[model samples]
Target: MNPLLQASPLPLFDQIQPEHIEPALDTLLRQAEDALSTVTAAEFPATWQAIAAELDVATEKLGVAWGSVSHLNAVADTPELRAAYNTCLPKVTEFWTRLGADERLYAKYKAIAPESLNTEQRQAHKNALRNFVLGGADLQGAERERFAAIQEQMAALSQLFSEHTLDATDAFSYYATREELTGVPDDVVQGARNAAQAEGKEGYKLTLKMPCYLPVMQFAKSSALRGTLYRAYVTRASDQAEDTAKQFDNTDTMRSILTLRKEEAALLGYPNFGALSVVTKMADSPTAVIRFLRDLAAKARPYGQQDVADMRAFAAEHLGLTDPQAWDWPYIGEKLKEARYSFSEQEVKQYFTLPKVLAGLFKIVETLFDVEITPDTAPVWNPNVSFYRLERVGPQGR
Candidate 1:
């Protein structure tokens, strides 16, 4: 059996390969399409449970299988895996676009009587109705066709943006001499050295991955080194990057995404994308959200201003950095924090081992939620990922 087609509760992560993607998705999508036809047939009842049993089950399987593929692509991307995902992306996108905008299915859903549903069912039905509208179920003729096209285009563009970001991030590397790595934490420097050795190189290797970038910014004594990294970090997937990196620039992609969003919003009778976004959210409108943010900023402005002033003074007097640049803030802040608190992140990290931290976290969660969490076995893509079982802490101990 294809691991993607396995009946296991969790995905068979270790067994699923790039080759399995197309066949698995083909079968799942066919099943989902068949289910949609079944549910929307003239003889079929428009009741919630009937449609759910046929349509929901098939679609859920498709979702889970696709989600697994997407997760693997994000965490453990390879050229083959990426190619497989891209090949299948448009098919998956098209199916979902059609399903959401199917007028027959929408009519069946409309035929479902709200009075027949219980409290939970009613809420679910209400949300589904709203979603169908937002999904362009009410659109007709050319407008509907355009809406579907826009969805597929947006999906493709979004995936392209993600690919560019990941590629840009992975493409960058900087090798620094031991003298250049001065004041960097011991573990980080050692890790960098190990990376360089893995590639048969002499000096320490550094990348923009957060583990290396963040600590380097905070603690590296070399201002030039910090500046070099800061520039690369900020300019990834942008035109500001070097010639090779400029190929991954998202400037045009971002503009196209925004243009499509505006068009989509207009098609759905929304003024702008922001207005459409809040329809499913708690905020009444975009204006309300903006007002709330402005109010928050007003309240926070004084403290933020004071913090900057204090950091500036500390940088000028103690560090002899009268003209601190953007890259200097994190270093100055860390130094200031260490001076005032008489502690550093490096010192704090020594006390909180991974095991100790996990124990503390689980203890707090178990106490608050009245549950017992225990280790359980499952196939994982990575060795570091451990599975756990959570049970209610009751007399029956389920």
Candidate 2:
């Protein structure tokens, strides 16, 4: 049996596998298409309940199933799972595009009487009408088709860019000797040593993962090591990655994505992509956002410039580093903080172990909200992930 076909409140991550993705997606897509057909039929009742019961239930199921696959691809990606996700992504994208473009479905949503609905239904109806207009539901033949095509293409390109970035990040590993790791924190060094030992290699292994990369940049004594790792980190998904063969360049992908977004907005009668984005968001207008950002930047620029100058002066006078570059920023910050404040970030980090932090956080939340949260070992996609459940406690609660 396909585990994905089994209905549950949450995904059965314990049973889901890469092999199940394609079949599950195909079945769910078919079901969703059939549901839309029912909802859009000529004789279908133009009522919220009719639409919700027939179409919304099927759509939610499809979303949940597909969401599980995509989430797993992000958190626990292997070659097989990645392949399956990439293969199914287009089909999923196409289904949503087709549904959104179905003028009949949009009309069905429009045909419902707002006065007949409860508050929730009325709110949903208002949103549905606005979204239909935004979705180009009223557009003529060629334009509507183009709009759907843009959505499908953009979805594919966005997924590709993300995959390439992740693959590029996972492709490089830097091995460092004990001497090169001087001034690095004990925990970071131990983690790096463990990484190398995991592969039966000697010395420390560093990667672009934030936990290792950030610490090394801030504390490693070797300027060469910091500069090399920083360059590799920033140039990920570009041609400049250390693993040249696995560059996973996103330059073309990003260009295509931006072009498509602009075209999509123009097709919908919006001046630009930013204008289209703000339609569904809280922002009033693109110009408003731009002005706000500019004003905020103007206010912060003075303090920011002074910060840079202070750091540059300190680095020159105390560290014997007359010149500093992009890679030197974190190292300088760490040194400056210690010299000025007599405290190091590593010292702070050591006192707050992961378990201690989580326990303290849970205590704070429980006290503040009068609720409970506990670890739920209900099979997560990644072993490192922790799932928790929250529930209200009544006066007689145990």
Candidate 3:
């Protein structure tokens, strides 16, 4: 009865129902346990190549299920979906950790002939060996148990941090009556009006989503309105008192994650997680990354300073204001741009409808890659969404 392992013939497991996730996960977990046991109990020479191949297949199957469930939870969150996802994530992590910590499996992989593998397979085996070593595969008795406990606890804490951040982001909303929305441009004002109507309200309602909020704050000419939005954005997660939750505050969670990551890295024999993570990325060291950022800032500093000076002078000349506040910056900048260039962003936006924008993007990509994307008319997750298949072109200008 597992949803993911169903016998239906829908590509990408499209027929998977939400109701089947819990039972499917239970079944999948048993299968995973059996696979791990079988690998660890093998008597013959257990090769890293064979072990890694099995691991890849098992992980891929479980990963498909986890990915679908997680995406559903993010986009269409309900209590049922949320509960299933939160409960399942830790189980998945524990399975991965258990396999990573298996000493017999590690020993078998360690015995593989390096000369027998190709370039890619050799790299994969080496990565597999590194994972086992870092995961404490060589530890015995109490040390192994302690490492498992640490990994599981870390997984749970990371989940808790993300859930708290999502809750905080979703909790705040603002409303402004038509009369109070005096300085907003007509298209944006109309958009807010439409939004209010959709929600069965008489006034505009602005939430934290970029589509609903950022444009209003950036273009609203009223300083009071901009300041209110800016303040809400910054103080969202502050603690009002000891017990009460302030607006969107993520302070304690941020501190918790930082401390946990440092501790976890130290336990794994790394100086810090930054080195553990970024040593594999394009930038080799923290010093190099910092230098890159500093160089960019230095390049930008003169133009930024001159722009700030020009804005202050313009605001003083037009509004008779001696001091230019941060709240006034966006509105005045827009005005300056329009006056100097005789062009407005809103006018440009009129020609770039969403569908037109997407079509243009498709054309650009097609020209670069020489691939074709034909739209399929099928029932999809959203009515506005379209699905395209990327087909490879043959060589010799096919």
Best by TM-score: 1
Which of 1 and 2 is ahead in TM-score? 1
TM-score of each: 0.98, 0.94, 0.86
What are the per-residue Cα lDDT tens digits for candidate 2 across 265-381?
A: 999898999999999988899999999999999999999999999999999998877899899999999999999999888778879999999999999999998899987766666
lDDT for 108 in candidate 1 is 95
**241: Cα error in model 2, Å:** 3.7
lDDT of 3 by residue, 1-398 (tens): 45577543222334445677777777777777766666667665466556656665666667676777777667767677778877787788888898887887788788889988889989888888888877778777876787787788777777666676676667766677777666677877788778778979888876666665667666776677777666655555555312333533556767766776776666667798776666457898777888999999999999999998988888788856578676667778877777778777777878999889988998988889888766765424445556776666658543
lDDT of 1 by residue, 215-280 (tens): 999999888999999999999999999879999999999999999999999999999999999999
Reference-based lDDT, each prediction: 0.95, 0.89, 0.71
Q: Residue 362 error for model 2, in Å?
A: 3.2
- The pairs that clash in candidate 3 are 236-247, 236-248, 236-249, 237-247, 237-248, 237-249, 238-249
Off by over 4 Å in 1: none
| Candidate 3 lowest-lDDT run of ten | 240-249
Better of 1 and 3 by TM-score: 1
lDDT accuracy of residue 87 in candidate 3: 76
Would you give me the overall lDDT of model 2?
0.89
